[model samples]
Target: MDTTTHVAQTERRRTSPPAGSAGPSAGADPRRGPKRLSPRMRKLTLLIHVIAAVSWLGLDVGLLTLSVTGRISDDPETIRAAYVAMDVFGDVLLIPVALFTLVTGVLLGMGTRWGLLRYHWVLTKLVLTLVAFTATVAALRPGLEQAARDALRTPPEVGAAASDVLVAPCVALALYTFMTVLSVYKPWGMTRFARERLGRPGAHGAARGK
Candidate 1:
């Protein structure tokens, strides 16, 4: 072959994509973002998350009922028993369930396209969950313990501790319900971070490149 022909053929081979390939932009673009969870794994994590959240709500309801009973009942024995049960439930069930819910929720947020802070609803949920978890550890459990101690006293005087137990659970229940609604409706649009990221040059192309 002529030297010029040989150089031209080599140049074509170097420039051309391999057979049946669509060149560099053909598949998922690594620049777009990190990989998400597999569909099945995501579903499994979601299931666990739902169960944990429901369980936490249920525990809160149970605690609220006990608190009301302890506060309203005239019988000293009944009040003591109710308060003791509340303490046990708080220590053995409530804290663990709240932690589980938080962990699973964070996992789902980070593992899926929704992202932890990419959307307003998701960010709100994360903030609320953190608040709830902190309250459970810092306030609710201590209140329950104080109420239990007051109930067990010789005179069985719960005093202001009774109100604390009742109020904490009421607030927690409200927060959980609101968070659940947020999950269902997913109101509000993307967060500022998401909006800014999407606005950057080649963002759409990178997304489509995936």
Candidate 2:
């Protein structure tokens, strides 16, 4: 008679999450992180960027329209209204839009493998975006605010012309247009650093990706 042998298979088991996980299961894949962004959050970020860009563009267009409609510095009341409108657009919307656009565009760009600083086009876009952002803060916003404050002192009709009102708006619109073109054409060639770093896995990913 042959002796029969029995084997016991021990299954490996996972430990429960430490109370400190804060809520997520400890066994969850750590690499995936918290899945910090939901479908909703991603959509929201994209929407915010779109809205901000449109707002910036629309503000420029609105100012131009006012000029075309003969609303600049000619009438006292119109000038005052323009002042209020610009301030509202600036304080309430434009600044926020700009900040959100800049931040979100950066985050989105970095998050994707497309890479923000690697390719020439992305680099150029980044430079232009920063330039546009700085110009808005330093030149554009100040000019509008000054126009408003000056409106307080200067006659509604003082030193005013359609050209005067349209000038800043047109300039801002041009920047916006340039930005849009860069986005569409992305004409930047390639960054030397990026080419050198190309073989590296996710340098851009390291910069932007979690």
Candidate 3:
């Protein structure tokens, strides 16, 4: 009888789940869903992303100021200085900061529930960032360089490139401001792809129900 009882206990132990283990259904599948960052890492990434974005915005504002000064100032030295400063900012700081902002934003989207294509706001921001980055590299930088060259000429004049240098920053500033508001408000709901991928109602649905 004791041997029979011992055998039964052994079988029970073999059949039972290990202590503290969750059932298969209780946790997410590692193979599925977006990869998540640890809470600390997420916070760090968010901080960096915000800093980079703000820096980009600040740079835009500075460029706008310089462009305006270069365009309107009668003093040759002042105009030359403004355009030179604009060129320097564009050459040394602008692209790197924009790149950092874009990369960090992408990382945050991929590493969190927000996801790259999950929501309208995120998608819009991504598109805007890409457009701004491309314009800065392709159009804005060249315009700044040309303006600086024009300013450095014997007469130090504002030329065709002046309009581009001024307008680009204004557009970029507006876009960045809009994107900032979007981040705060997050107005739109999830995309159709996200809804289908999640296989359930998303945050908007949950909020409405609440």
Candidate 1's residue-wise lDDT over 43-113, tens digit each? Answer: 99899999999999898899889989987899999999999999999889988899899999999989877
Highest lDDT scorer: 3
- Name model 2 segments beyond 4 Å from true: 1-43, 67-73, 160-165, 199-210
**Which ranking of candidates, highest lDDT first?**
3, 1, 2
Model 2 Cα shift for residue 67 (angstroms): 5.2
The global Cα lDDT (0 to 1) of model 2 is: 0.64
Relative to the true structure, how large is the alpha-carbon lDDT of every model?
Answer: 0.87, 0.64, 0.90
Q: Write the per-residue lDDT of candidate 2 for residues 1-210, one digit (tens) a residue.
A: 333322222221234444556444445532222334566876787788788788878977876775454353467777677665765676677677777778887765665444676567767667777887887787767666666666566565434433455577787788778878877886745455755554544445565555
- Per-prediction TM-score to the true structure, in the order listed: 0.81, 0.65, 0.81
Q: How accurate locally is residue 148 in candidate 3, as Cα lDDT from 0 to 100?
A: 95
Error of 1 at 71 (Å): 0.9
Q: Which pairs of residues collide in model 3?
A: none
Q: Superposing every Cα of model 3 onto the true structure, what RMSD results?
A: 5.6
Count: clashes, candidate 2: 0
Q: What residue pairs are clashing in model 1?
A: none
On lDDT, the stronger of 1 and 3 is 3
